[model samples]
Target: MDVVAFKQFINDQIQLFAEKLGDAKHSSNDGVSLGKLTFYLAVRQSIDKKASEQDMGLVGAFNDTLQALGMVEPGKTFMSKLDT
Candidate 1:
């Protein structure tokens, strides 16, 4: 997916989870914490060797977008299941 689409997808997922956790107003620090927790969990899961191909692809796209936006160093790896 393109960068814009990827961002939208992330936002949508976060919003869905926030709503599920009773953060429909999304005005609480707890909501932010939950979002961060969810994101990290997804990252960890994506880097697992047994992760689905789709999960890996999503994480790769996320890392690529971060690099492209200068949020991460170019060619710097985040999580590599092979390194474990």
Candidate 2:
């Protein structure tokens, strides 16, 4: 787990997102609603795709720690076991 590399990756993502944000068309405050939603989804999808390709070892380690502490159960999705 190279901390420097991880930081660089996140910084790169932030810069890219910021550039997209600046380029987003906002002719008027009322006209930006759809554009904002589209940009938000694009950023979210981009981050998810990039993250899936990276080997961030800490993410696995953190999940394992949570499982060991019984904070997370195996083979169960959070959405499937709602408190309500």
Candidate 3:
């Protein structure tokens, strides 16, 4: 999908999750944790040598959403490698 479509899909997914989790702050904590887990899994999948382009796309999409939401700094994502 194109960038716009991908972004829209991500936004929709986020909203859906939020709605399903309800407005209760305490209940939403689990949703946040689930999101983090999903992100880490995507990151790990992206780094796998056997990963397909689709896997990397998912990682990129997740990173894009994070950056868009200001949850991450520009050009810095879980996929970024630290300088040794």
Candidate 4:
């Protein structure tokens, strides 16, 4: 499939899976959606994997620092200057 088709397919699958999970299983009671949590976890896992492969702790540390500073939030890819 083309890149666009593949992306759409992935989106459709995630939507279907989310719908199957519904509100109860799809999200925690903290109001964070499962999609957001999943995205954050995926990013963390990728960072960890890269660090492990490269034998560098700085990558993970950088991720942690970003999280601690609230520069990276679940499901948020960019911090808009206009938001504040």
- Rank ordering of all candidates by TM-score, starting from the highest: 1, 3, 2, 4
Model 4 agreement with the true structure over 1-78: per-residue lDDT tens digits: 444454454466556655655766544542444544455444344433542432234434545577778987644433
Candidate 2 local lDDT, 24-60, one digit each (tens): 4533443344444443444334434543322233344
Off by over 4 Å in 1: 1-41, 79-84
For candidate 2, which ten residues in a row score worst on lDDT? 75-84
Q: How far is candidate 2 from the true structure (C-alpha RMSD, Å)?
A: 13.7
lDDT winner between 1 and 2, please give it.
1
As a whole number from 0 to 100, the lDDT of residue 51 in candidate 3 is: 52
Error of 1 at 77 (Å): 2.8
lDDT digits (tens) for residues 1-84 of candidate 1: 444454455567666666656754555566565756467446555533555676577677878988888877877744421232
Q: What is the lDDT of residue 5 in candidate 3?
A: 52
Best by lDDT: 3
TM-score of 2: 0.31
Q: What is the lDDT of residue 6 in candidate 3?
A: 48
After superposing candidate 2 on the true structure, give the runs of residues whose Cα lies further than 4 Å from its correct spot: 25-84
CA lDDT of 64 in candidate 3? 86
State TM-scores per candidate.
0.43, 0.31, 0.40, 0.30
Tell me how candidate 3 scores on lDDT: 0.61
